[model samples]
Target: MSTQQFAGANDRFLRRYEYDDSWIVAADLGVADDAVDVDVVGTTAIVVVDTGDGVAETEFELPGTDADVAVQNGVLTITVAK
Candidate 1:
C-alpha cells in the first residue's frame, strides 16, 4: 500500500497553510503546540483526544465529536485510528 502525506504532516503546512493568520489567530486545537509533541510514523492527523487537562484535540476521519486519539499527563499521547 502507498502512503499519502496529508497537509498536517508537512511542517510548512502546519505552520503556514493550516494555521496562518496575522491579526486573527486560531486555537492550536490540542496537538499544535511546540510544548505538545506527536508521532505519526504510519498515518495520523485531524484527531481529537481528551487531555483531561481541560482540553480536547481535533477529530480525524470521524465527524463532529469523533476522532481517534490518546492522552497523557507527562509524556505525549499516542493516537491511532480505530
Candidate 2:
C-alpha cells in the first residue's frame, strides 16, 4: 500500500502526505496536544480535534496492516505493514 491510500479523509484541519513507507497526517497550527487525538480502529484512522469552541473530527479507512501512529512536530505519521 502507499501513503496516498491513507489520505481518504478530507478536512480543513489535516493534511496527508505520502512517504516511502509511511503515511503522514499533519495537524494544522493551533491544534494542541490536548486538543487533538488520533486512533486506529481496525483499518480506520480517526482523528479528533477540539478547540475552545467545539470539537471536530475526521476518519479515514487506512490501507495495509500492522499500523502504527505517531505524533511529533505537530504532525501525525501513520506507518503500516504492507
Candidate 3:
C-alpha cells in the first residue's frame, strides 16, 4: 500500500491510501454528515464542508474515475476504484 498527504484549504489535510484495487481519501472536518459535499470531475475530487463558522472547500487529484463518498463522526471518507 502507498500513502499520500494533501494540503487543503484553511490548512486542512487529506490522507490518501492506495491498495491493490482501490484508493481511499479521508479527512476530519468536524462537521455533521449532512454538512459535507463531495464531487468528482474526471481525475479531480472536490470537497466542500460546512464548519459552522463558514464553508471550506478543497480539491485534489483522484486516481480513479468512480468514487464512493461517505461522512460519519465528522470524518469524510472517499473510496475509488483503481
Candidate 4:
C-alpha cells in the first residue's frame, strides 16, 4: 500500500503574465539564480523570483499540452504550443 501525503507544495504567491505570440512574458526578476525558480504545476506554469527585498511570483496559463520555460535578459518566458 502507498500512502499519499501532501508535501506542502502550495503556491506561495499568485501573479499574472502578459501573453504574446505563442509565449507568455513574466516580470523582470533581476539576476540571481538562487532567488529564481520555475515550475510546472498541472496545466499552469509558475515562476518564483526573489530579489533580497521580496519574492515575486508569476503564473502563465498554458494553452496546449507542452510548455517550455526559460529566463533570458532578466525576464521569464514561457512558451506553449498546440
Best by TM-score: 3
- Pick by lDDT: 1 or 2, better one: 2
lDDT of 1 by residue, 1-82 (tens): 2222334432312221111211111123344334443333333344333445644444333111222333444233332222
* TM-score on alpha carbons, each prediction: 0.22, 0.62, 0.84, 0.55
Model 4 lDDT, residue 69, Cα: 74
Q: lDDT-based ranking, best first?
A: 3, 2, 4, 1
- For each of the candidates, give the backbone clash count: 4, 0, 0, 0
* Candidate 2, poorest ten consecutive residues by summed lDDT: 1-10
Best of the two (1, 3) by TM-score: 3
Worst 10 residues of 1 by lDDT: 16-25
**lDDT score, candidate 3, position 44:** 88
Global CA lDDT computed for model 1? 0.31
**Deviation (Å) of 60 in candidate 3:** 1.4
**Model 3 pairs whose backbones collide:** none
Candidate number that wins on TM-score, 1 or 2: 2
